[model samples]
Target chain A: MKIRIFVTLKNGVLDPQGKAIHHALESLDFKGVNDVRAGKLIELDVDDGTSDSDIEKMCEKLLANTVIENFEIERPTDQAAREA
Target chain B: MKIRIFVTLKNGVLDPQGKAIHHALESLDFKGVNDVRAGKLIELDVDDGTSDSDIEKMCEKLLANTVIENFEIERPTDQAAREA
Candidate 1:
């Protein structure tokens, strides 16, 4: 199964990369950008039988640093139908 | 309005970061992992009136390197209803 994991910094955590992007956008003359945050989108191709807990373990063990990062897992079965 | 932009390497492009992640998973004894790809997720807080073309411009000009990467833009209006 295909799984997607989004790892984002928790609120109140400092994000220097995000701040840099925000500055770059301003220099490019793109207006009205209130804020910018950067995160990770990891795509994994795992076996269909991989259990939920196993995926969670992956996140907790390696994919995310629990202290300042939050992860959200999207299983193939949970994905909403996309519009082509 | 909130907008999400996902930037991923084009097919056939090398991803060293992804390879490192895959190797780490194996060392940790996680199995059934077929492939892994790493990408960037950028979240922006922009004006509600920002036009689609403007967002596209942002991606083309700064967010993504069109030669080796592809970017997908998701507007708040395009999001599917979530279960919460």
Candidate 2:
């Protein structure tokens, strides 16, 4: 099975990389871009038996820094349905 | 309005960061982790009038590297319903 994990900075956290991108956008003449925040997307291919809770445990143990980041998991099959 | 851009490496492209993460997970004893790939998620706050085509233009100009990356855009309100 394929799983996707999105790790994003928590509210109020300072994101220097995001700031840099925002600046880059402004310099590129892209107007009306009020703010920008950047995060990580980690895709994993695991055994079919991998349960949802196991994935959550993986996030808590290593995938995310809970102190300053939050994570959301998605299955590609489910995501495709939503996209359609 | 809020927009999300997911940038991922194209297939066949080498991803050292992803390799490192996979190694880390193995060392941590997380079984069934077959493969891992890492990418970026960029969130933007823009004016409500910002058109979808304009956002696509942003991706082409600076948000994503067309040479080895692909980007997908999503609006928060639309995503919320899908999640529910």
Candidate 3:
């Protein structure tokens, strides 16, 4: 099975990169775009029996830097429908 | 108040950028590193009482390009505790 981890900056913290992109978007005439934030994704291919706790551990230990970021995990079938 | 959104690619898809970074990590002697995926994060500064559904709408409507990606929303208080 495969597990996907998404990591992102926590709220209330300033995101310099997001601000830069927001500015760039505005300069490019993309209006109504208020702000931006940035994050990372990690994909893990594992045996079919990886537990949810294990996946969470991966997010906690490696996939994300918890001090300023948050992460979420999704299974393939669940993610495919949720995003769309 | 603020809302933070995280967008990530779905599993089973190839992440060329992540692969490149993985190779770089290996070259740098970071062992046990397997694969990486890339994604985006968005931070929105809004009224203190923005509804959960409204934030969900933002993710569904624009912040996340759902076709190949998935997104999650976390309130400041929740995210701060969850990630840590």
Candidate 4:
């Protein structure tokens, strides 16, 4: 199975990288961009039998720093098609 | 309006960061982890009137490296609720 994890900074956390990107956009004259926040996407190819709890444990242990980040897991329906 | 952009490395590209993450998971004894690929998620808060073409141009110019990365744009449906 293929699982996708999105790890994003919690609201109110300072994101310098995002700020840098925002500045870059402004320099390029892309108006209307109010703010930017950056995050991470981790794609994992794992055994089909891997339990949801185990996956959650993975996130808690290393995939995310829960103190400043929140993570969402997605099991894409297209994984079956891809495996087939 | 809020938009999300997912940027992922193209297939066959070497991802050292992902490799390191995979190794870390193995060290932590997370079984069934076959492969890991890492990417970026960029969130943009923009004016409601921003055109889709302008957003696409932003991605092409700064958000993604078209030579080795692919980007997907998403306009979340819950933006209304959040703004409310």
Query: Which predicted model would earn the best DockQ?
Result: 2
Residue A45's lDDT in candidate 3: 61
What ranking of all candidate models by DockQ puts the best one first? 2, 1, 4, 3
Q: Write the per-residue lDDT of candidate 1 for residues B20-61, one digit (tens) a residue.
A: 999999999999998999999999999999999999999999
Chain B TM-score (model 1 vs. true structure): 0.92
Best by lDDT: 2
Give one digit per residue, the lDDT tens place, for model 3 in A1-84. Answer: 656676778888787877875675556544354566666656666556667776676667656779988887867665555444
Misplaced by over 4 Å in model 2 are: none
Give all candidates' CA lDDT scores.
Answer: 0.90, 0.92, 0.66, 0.90
Clashing residue pairs in candidate 3, if any?
A37-B41
lDDT of each residue in B51-75, candidate 3, tens digit only:
7876676667556778888887866
Model number with the top TM-score:
2
Steric clashes per prediction: 0, 0, 1, 0
* Model 2: per-residue Cα lDDT over A1-84, one tens digit each: 888899999999999999999999999899999999999999999999898998998899999999999999988766875576
lDDT of 4 by residue, A1-84 (tens): 889888999999999999999999999999999999999999999999999899999999999999999998877553333233
Cα deviation at B72, candidate 2, in Å, is 0.7
TM-score of each: 0.94, 0.94, 0.55, 0.90
- lDDT at residue B20 of model 1 (Cα atoms): 95
Point out where model 3 deviates above 4 Å: B1-35, B39-84
B1-84 in candidate 2: lDDT tens per residue? 989899999999999999999999999888999999999999999999999999999999999999999999988765775586
Query: Candidate 3 chain B, which ten residues in sequence have the lowest lDDT sum?
Result: B25-34
- Residue range B27-71, candidate 4, lDDT tens digits: 999999999999999999999999889999999999999999999
